[model samples]
Target: MGRGIVKVWYDPEGDFLEVLFEKKEGYFRETSDDRVMEKVDMQGHVIGFSVLGTRNLAKMPLEVALS
Candidate 1:
């Protein structure tokens, strides 16, 4: 598979962080945690992820897995 561009967007004002693996047609969905969410394409491949609280990340356990 061809590799896609990766992009990271952080909204300081909103305290949100988004890491995009591929910029394509996709939608965001909430993961198990309320502070985390992921984006998936039509084929069900994860394209990106978002975190609600970025500043407090250091205080909590952080692990990213989509399975």
Candidate 2:
């Protein structure tokens, strides 16, 4: 058994980002979503991950976020 997951990867040529949504274990099932990728810089201490909004995506820094 495995955990459910979503993955984000860089797309340099398209100038956009790729998102992969997957249901873990059992069947090999996965799909992708197209998103405009950008970088996010955190203040204070960078903690665990949180859900992001459209506005948050817009505010991120392209250089760092792509990683």
Task: Give the number of the best model, judged by lDDT.
Answer: 1
Model 2 agreement with the true structure over 1-67: per-residue lDDT tens digits: 1345556655455454444443222221211222332222343222112222333466763223322
> Model-by-model lDDT, in order?
0.85, 0.34
lDDT of 1 by residue, 1-67 (tens): 2376678899999999998888789888878888888999988889889999889988986786764
Clashing pairs in 1: none
